[model samples]
Target: MMKKFGFTLAEVLITLGIVGVIAAMTIPTFVTNSQNKANAAKLASTISNIENAFGIMMVQEGANTLDETEFYQYLTNKDLEKAESTFGEYLKLQGNGTVTNFYGEDKPFKYIGYSAVPENITLSESIDVYQTKNGALLMFADGFNEITEDVAKKYGISVTKQYFLLRIDVNGKENPNIIGRDVFVFALCEDGALYPFGGKTSSVIQTGNPTSRHYKNSSGSYACIDGKFSAGCTARLIENNFVVDY
Candidate 1:
């Protein structure tokens, strides 16, 4: 027989063990990467759908200032009426005025398809259409109306207050400047100016919390919109198709 180039049993076992160890370490990483990529694709697709609907609505209505309800209504009423669409089917607005689909649940307009699910999204809360005293809208969670009196007192704002231009910054903390008040509004001006209305500025604004900003402070990472922290800003903007100037 040709001098066997193949390794002996012991040597082969050792090599196999090493290969197994490497594979064990890399498989989870690969899976995680794959999941992230899939989620990204889904998000992009959803955003495109939403933007397309918005574009249609704008063309028909001759305006770009539609509320969350109006946007959904446009999709379900007009877009779906004309074209059989996936997003319209996925977003089954309920009789109680809530919307549901593959995503968990949403409180109207605060967040639409913003949560992270393997295949769907959940709405974070309802949108606050009011403005704050400082001219910034109280942009945060949608369940603001459900906050307890003590919690409201702690934040120095009421549950009925609304915020505009909400930003869960890189630190994952809600900007204190936008907390509390009614009628929050952040206008993305034609000149590319971001203006916040309502709420007062405090000298010591807390920053960095995963709940609000969705990033660990020690990591020095920035807040990600829609629970995706690793993607670029342009990708996010393009996906959402909404102006997130924060």
Candidate 2:
């Protein structure tokens, strides 16, 4: 007759310990990768929604260009209420179309390292916030500046007119609402295109190329600095095929 086939207590413990070690080594990495993928997807969808809303609004308003739309004028004039309301109408917002000031008392966004806040992002200025039906919060700021002659020469792009600035929270009011994480910044260019903030230019959007020249993927002002707020991280993420490697 065969003896007891099962391993002794020591052998069983050893095997279990090996399995535990393997799991411990891999679980956190797996979880992080999964979260990164989810964030990337959410960001992609948000971008598409915002762009589509603008396109639809332009069509309905009988406007051939974004400058012809009321939203553009409102933004130019820094009229938060009208700009936010127009966006709400175009996007078919679920709640009351209200544009709230998310400035002054407390800011909704946080740095990558909340406790050790960095100066990469400035929240002292006023910003207009609107929550979309999809749970993404759009923060609008009249932060655009004309691409100076020096900047044009450096990037080699002919873009002169600066457009709107958008700080978006892909997960709405969820935890870890930090820039370069759930929050991202973009430049809504006069060309009716959105480019990752800190990017060299909007040529990446205009050309439909992921690997474009002078486009800040993971470098320059928009680089994804560890434990710091980097608004241009959005462009870096997009250039890296939505992979949140950082």
Candidate 3:
């Protein structure tokens, strides 16, 4: 008789209801956390791929030093056609998919927000943009500074020395495309390989130059905070191997 003792039907139902409530409260948080982790991994993989490719090409060309313009001559063109030829034809990649020298699409990219867009221009509208199969975005203009050649001349800089910007939309045009959260700026120096905008954060890159200036802004919060943009976190996350710490 004692062994038959158990909770009544009403008590069991109450217990189940409490369990459901707890799940409802926690599931969304868990889902978000999981997605963030996966996105972080994607960011790491994507940037690493680009960096490695650049290194291999440089070594093959036997180049010890290359300015931005020379790098493009060694790598891509105005339309990055050579990039497609090597990375696509030979490497069997989607050629990282070519993009035009135009801004947003006749179909705008679904996720148009930029967490850390530069102080210089419009996020999606001002730059020529391209998207890759891995969900990363390549944004560059004809010259530097602005999307026109005049700007480069005004700055006395060529397109090669000015460098290009990368916005990695972890989900690729998906919703909640907040910059820094879903996107980060991976800036490639005109003369150096790709590194997060705030390059000093990378131990490997900043190794001997403790006093060297990599990024002017030093905000390192994972999410764009205090009105700070996502670009600030690029070097931070890159140095951390693309694992964003909350």
Candidate 4:
């Protein structure tokens, strides 16, 4: 009979060492990739729901314009009762999900810049602060602001309705709420369309360019890019197919 011999102890130990080294090198990368993918999915889902809400509102309301008040009525009507306070009347929410409000001493959100750096931002209590059922925190505020003639042309669009901004934290109550990281910003135009930070006009539709008039990707910083919202990283995130740059 042919003699069969097991590998020596030294060979086994060497093989195990190599395996351990490979695992050590690749495990963190695998984890990071998995987490990033999860965050991206959450962001995409939130954006889709918001867009669908607006689309449905347009179909039902038979109108093309939306104020902050009207938009939430269609967007987050179901969770109206759960909020601490609202600026305008809410009629119905497109989905039957819960939205909890947080303001005052209980506020659980923070601000950040496009470079995924934290910032000092004192949020006015007048704004609405709420967390969606999908674990997204929405910092919403709406009002009309004047735009200079030069600014309008530079943004590649004519003046529109009262400006409404939405800053979203894809994973509510999670750490690293930095914009361009877990959080992103968006603008709901009076025309009833949702645009990313860098103006969704004919000239620039989600251009991640750092020099965009609406807002550009911050270099080693995260400052509110749009004249209205902070960080302006959403435009770049969208341009990058919803991938967050570390």
- Best-performing candidate as measured by TM-score: 2
Scored against the true structure, residue 148 in model 1 reaches a CA lDDT of 42
* Deviating ranges (above 4 Å) for candidate 4: 1-4, 62-64, 68-119, 122-126, 142-144, 148-155, 158-162, 198-230, 243-246
lDDT of 4: 0.55
- Cα lDDT tens digits, model 1, 81-116, are 322232233232211121232113342222112433
Off by over 4 Å in 3: 1-4, 62-77, 80-83, 86-92, 95-121, 124-135, 141-162, 199-226
Q: Report the Cα lDDT for candidate 1.
A: 0.31
**Ten residues in a row with the worst lDDT in model 2?**
96-105
Point out where model 1 deviates above 4 Å: 1-5, 68-246
lDDT of 3 by residue, 3-36 (tens): 7778999999999999999999999998877877
Model 1 residue 168 CA deviation in Å? 16
lDDT of 4 by residue, 108-160 (tens): 34444323222434454545555556667766665444445465567666544
- lDDT (0 to 1) per candidate: 0.31, 0.67, 0.51, 0.55
Tell me the number of clashing residue pairs for each predicted model: 33, 0, 5, 7
Error of 2 at 44 (Å): 1.4
Tens digit of per-residue lDDT, candidate 2, span 13-102: 999999999999999889868877887899998888888888888888988777899988886676766777887786755432223333
| CA displacement after TM-score superposition, residue 203 of candidate 2 (Å) | 11
Q: At residue 57, what lDDT does model 2 achieve?
A: 88
Residue 55 CA displacement from its true place in model 1, Å: 2.0
TM agreement with the true structure for every prediction: 0.37, 0.74, 0.63, 0.63
